[model samples]
Target: MPFSVPPYRLSQAIRDKCKRLHVFVQAFTLPSCWYPHRIRILAPHPVRNKCGNAVRIKTPKTGSAVPTLADVARHANVSTATVSRCLNSPDQVVGETRKRVLKAVQDLGYAPNFSARALAAKRTKTIGAVIPTMDNSIFARGIQAFQEELGRHGFTLLIASSAYREDLEEEQIRTLAARGADALLLIGYHRNRAVYDMLTARNLPVLVAWAYHADAPQMSIGFDNVTAMAGLARLAIGKGHRRLGFISAPGATNDRARDRVAGVRRAMREAGLRDTDLSLVETQYGIETGEAAFREIMTSATPPTVVLCGNDVLAVGALRAAKEMGLRVPQDVSITGFDDIELAMLAEPPLTTVHVPHREMGRRAAGMLVQILTGQGRPDNVELKTDIRIRQTLGPPPPER
Candidate 1:
């Protein structure tokens, strides 16, 4: 009797040898009992033993072997420094040399390691933006414009959503900062002082957007929310809407919502109407929530003649709820919304709302951030303007009924 290698161990041994030699066993079989055996060897080719079944082997993969700067330089027959200059400062290199270097980069599928570059350059050339939500189109247009402008300046945008939670926004701010964002774009100046202190400690340039206050401590780029909403409220009041109803987002957490509510009160005071003349409801921002809030306001003992909403989403919801309640818009009860989003225009009867320059605000915000990052003097706070879009929804109270 002779000792024999176990089938599993023998197979593993063959596999190990095959990997080292870059070849594989095509087909093989082991003896059923303990016996001495011999395996025929093949170099650089598939090896088969007794069985017809081929034991297939795969060639080793080189996919993880990333092409580096030196690889690009060698492929282009240039120095690594020349390759770096070509990528970072292409204008400094001659046209022909630049073309050759770029071609080699394309051919070798070489991508510069941005992590190393950011480490050496001490700037990631990236901006982080945190908004309240992404579930609606309210911030969509502005963010798109912001990203486009940043791309033109060779910087990338990293966006995160806080879902309207201040705690989450603070976490996102720290996370973005830790990940090396060169600058930041925050929605409002309502966050905790600790967050601002952290940004200051890190020396990160920040620009506040979506709400503008002349006396805000931080640099900001946005319209005056209070004034804009006040202008809209005045128009509604001028139309003789003495008995007013307002559907709004929670004012405590959001400066924009709070300021808009202040604007309505300002208009009410200007018109000599007591605060009791206006009915108010605060809810989350959504079409359904708007509908529910509208129904609640209208079912009161003294219902308003005109319902003013915080934004277009809530206004559209109110428009639907009003129709359900058999109330004719402007004739029976009027409705007005803020933010002039696309839904405002597409409402059953186009919404009477305030038109904000969302795209312009976004672009200018990016420009201001870039200016600060590039060591240009910090730009002054910008105040964009808003207009009132009077559509079919707003009108005088119904015949004093």
Candidate 2:
């Protein structure tokens, strides 16, 4: 039996066409040494005559084709374990043997699995901090010092800012803890109960800073806001400033501001003046807010001779406003502030403010937290001193006019 072509199909014509196509393809066929299945259909190859023969070719042997660690051990005259130790813990092997195995590894470019080493060590050597806000230089400066101190001890610091929201701060704290932070640093004593509970439940060491109260529930490392502010108020009164105005943070929930206002009232009472003689304006902590608060006091029937600000930031605003109003600072209007930030000295008349030891506080806080983490001691209350930086902004009243 023989194959037959249908109508309109010629057997001789089909056979001739197939023979021509085979020649066209054979001209571009890969070398016999090349893996035919691995080559793309459209891949280019050396051209050849119709003779069926392999082309002389060479290809680089990549990792998938080459011998691995086991082969390296066999070639090095050592066990696989000895080969791995030479690649990793070289000090554990004899010097001469280590050199031989290392030479074999170098020749083969064998890389040990780093994941295995990391799993064995089980330490990231990192610390975590959550602060109220980085926008304010207070936290930024303090956190910078904290990180520098941590770096000195060969530890890395991871920081997150909550922008003064308690909920966000707590969530960030949890996130850092979950990511394997050995210790945590927080700002201020006031946080949600659940945050404290979370840390307690995890047995995590936590340190609070910024504002300090002797009997706070958590460990704290800071200063007495009331005593520091009150001392300044008493000093201002002693300098013959009978009419005093206080520019402070809204006392609604800020204990530090509330205590500062209390200090001013206490000083006024001690000077045989009615508490009414002291006018207090609660405002946000900003230069603009300080200016507005100062203006409000100035427009009063009994304008104050001395104005005390919650912090140096507000004092600057008050000073700028006084200058704009054609008033001479410390002469027409004496001003004092807390937290002698760098901006205090940069003012036209340097600010007479309390110098909060920001860097020292941060360093001390880190130390206390480290102590707690290492079981050296439990959390304790710490109160660092706040000294007065007497500059040109504070002076006696203008002849009691």
Candidate 3:
């Protein structure tokens, strides 16, 4: 036999320095180079630099090698069966043997092969998430909570962003599904039909978030978009704001935006204000867009006394625009926003917006997914509550108005 060391030999506790060094080189050949300090590599089969003289080249081990169970058993002076028990069911092994075996394995640079374990167990305990965008703090906060909860259940999370694009979101879904994700999480219900079909065909357990509807085709774990936004609009209306300027995201493609716009319209309708009485400006959801939309809304024949933004990002820009235009917030023009993000409170006047329970929703979503994955239970639509955060940002119409 070619002087080849067994895979398990490297994992044995090598008291002999020569044997340890020999096992190190034989175990790892060329691929394992991640932790350079852990192992040394020497030029194997070194030949003489000059004429016919034969010289032996030391083979250096540069990384941790694959250490089998037998290697650990021999190193620890225990039977292979005992080593197996220590790894598979440690409670059956005595304390002294377990400790010695573990220490020996550590000294011999031994690590369990997770891939083989995964194959045997038939489970990866991983969840995947596909969001429209991570640029928004709302998504980021929710995902952080989601991952935290998953960690408690001994599961890992893989996340990807799609930049609010339907096609890219679909692609992420396919990629995650192919990566052996036990469960999947998505931002919203709106997506390509093909993607939905693929998920259904593969029988992947998917949870949709952000906006929830009872009749939605997919499972959801989110608040009712129409109701949440409606509550905010109602709060704005209760403040005696009759003339309104709505700075909303373009509703043509985004169902969430459409629902928010609908909520605003419903509030205006209840107040006996016709559609003509409200000035609506559709723009991208950004600070720059907010500023431009606010300026445009103010240019109306009869400028509205209050401006309601789609979200906090736009509200911040709107507030800046008001100051630039010599208008004091609440006194010159009342401003209201949605999604009470961190920036909402930091604005000149703390934002009067709807506080979304992002963390709670994320936790519940993760918990539900874990339950489903473990065959514990399935979750119904998780409707998280939202509250209207009344702040100094919104007040009665200006005295000038």
Name the top TM-score candidate: 1
Write out the backbone clash pairs for model 3.
8-71, 13-75, 40-60, 40-61, 41-60, 41-61, 42-59, 42-60, 46-57
Among the numbered candidates, top lDDT falls to 1
lDDT of each: 0.86, 0.78, 0.80
Q: Where in model 1 is the C-alpha error above 4 Å?
A: 1-65, 68-106
Ranking by TM-score: 1, 3, 2
What's the TM for model 2?
A: 0.68
lDDT of 2 by residue, 24-117 (tens): 6555765443433322222234423457553333354454645477878887899998886665445678988888887887887777554554
CA shift of 178, model 2, Å = 3.3
Query: How much does each candidate deviate from the true structure in C-alpha RMSD?
Result: 10.1, 12.4, 9.9
Q: For candidate 1, what is the lDDT?
A: 0.86
Off by over 4 Å in 3: 1-64, 67-114
- For every model shown, what is its TM-score relative to the native structure? 0.78, 0.68, 0.75
- Candidate 3 per-residue lDDT over residues 1-401, each given as its tens digit: 12256333543343244344644554465433343322322223222323535433344564766777888888999998887677655677899998998898788888767577668877667899988677789988899999988886767899998877777878889999988888899877777788888988988999998888888877788887788877777777787777888899877657888888888889888888888878999988789999999999997789998898888999999999999999998888889888889999999988888889898889989999988888887778877888889899888776652
Backbone clash numbers for all candidates listed: 2, 0, 9
lDDT of 1 by residue, 1-401 (tens): 21164334456656556434332223232333221122223222444434534334344355768899999999989999999888765677898899999999999899888888898989998999999999767689899999888776767899999988999999999999999999999998898999999999999989999989888879999989889989988998898889899999998889899989999999999999999998999999999999999999999999999999999999999999999999999799999998888888899899999999999989989899989988898999999999998899998889864
